[model samples]
Target: MNDYLKNGLFLAAGVAIGALGAVALGKGKFSIRPAMADLLSHGMDLKEKTATVLERAKENLDDLMAEAKHAKESREGKSVAEGETA
Candidate 1:
């Protein structure tokens, strides 16, 4: 009987502590001003635009590399022909 009473009291104390902790750690309200919201949206748009520019730059770089490779092959072929003639 005494053991049961002690156990019940412990359980009640644990429940009360948990409830208090939950209330203290709950999230509060959040609000953003209209000007700040517009700024944030504009920033996101700029990031998307920058990403598109970088993608185009990467494609241009690839094309340049292909052209350079072709040019190098042509130069090597010419050098080989000159060597044979010599």
Candidate 2:
């Protein structure tokens, strides 16, 4: 109930949780990298983000079209496009 006791408990809980999290991330594919990755990824954006997203969108659409072509070629049933050459 004392203010000092509450503060001590809070500090202790923070330390314990931090220690546990550090240990958990110590060895894994999800382990935290250096601050550079976070700074570069989370900071800035605005104009850069829009262009980056649009570029990725174009790439994704190209990939999707390639997949569709592969699927169309693989189909064994009646030709869906009729006269379209393989």
Output the worst ten-in-a-row residue range by lDDT, candidate 1.
Answer: 24-33
| Candidate 1 residue-wise lDDT at 55 | 100
TM-score of each: 0.55, 0.35
Worst 10 residues of 2 by lDDT: 76-85
Q: Candidate 1 vs. truth: CA RMSD?
A: 17.1
- Give lDDT: candidate 1, residue 7: 100
Model 2 has an lDDT value of: 0.79
Clashing pairs in 1: none
The total of clashing pairs for model 1 equals 0
Q: For residues 1-86, write the lDDT of model 1, one tens digit per residue.
A: 69999999999999998786566556424333565579889999999999999999999999999999999999999999999999
Tens-place lDDT per residue, model 2, 29-55, is 564566547765766655588889999
Model 2, residue pairs in steric clash: none
Candidate 2 ranges beyond 4 A from true positions: 1-45, 76-86
